[model samples]
Target: MTKHIIETVTFRLKDGVKPADFAKSATAMNAYVSGCTGFIARRLSYNADGLWIEHIEWQDMDAAKAAAAGIGAPEGNRPFLSAIDGPTVTMTHTELEVSVN
Candidate 1:
């Protein structure tokens, strides 16, 4: 079987944007993400330092890359994107090394 691809995005919220506010946008963006081809699952978490991490699993790298490139276009993603401090964002994609249920 082919290994799945995992995409990790780390970012901070824009100044004055609260976590709750970001969540609402994330919830809305979920619909757009779920509709994308090869999307498998997504998880969002935050650290005490106010850093947010988003993990998305895709069927393959192509899907992950494609989704990342188009994520900003959907209306559902607008608020989510706008809530982020763009310069603080970092993203990476890696082959799934191992996973357990």
Candidate 2:
């Protein structure tokens, strides 16, 4: 059976970066990823500790891996990358095993 893939990235904004700027970059990043093959959905959220989390859903592992290669391209990701504190970023990928909702 085909399994869904969840790609999560957690990071903090670079020093002196404004939330508005990050939002704009994120919106562009979302729009770009939405056009890739097997793209499902994506959401960006933050916690009180000032760390942001991006949750992206893909049709399967293959799709996620394929898209990962282009994540740092200048097309729509440069601004987003510029806003992030690179050293603080952490990413992981997982296959959906079960879902209640």
Candidate 2: worst 10 consecutive residues by lDDT? 67-76
Candidate 1's displacement at residue 48, Å, is 1.0
Report the number of the highest-TM-score candidate: 1
- Residue 20 deviation, candidate 1, in Å? 0.5
RMSD of each: 0.9, 1.4
lDDT digits (tens) for residues 1-101 of candidate 2: 88899999999998899888899989988767998899988989998888999988999988998888878875678988888998999999999787665
Clashes of each: 0, 0
Q: Tens digits of per-residue lDDT for model 1 on 1-101? A: 88999999999998999999899899999998999999999999999999999999999998998888898888778999999999999998999989887
The models' CA-based lDDT, in order, is: 0.92, 0.88
Considering only N, C-alpha and C atoms within 3 Å, which residue pairs clash in candidate 1? none
Off by over 4 Å in 2: none
Clashes of 1: 0
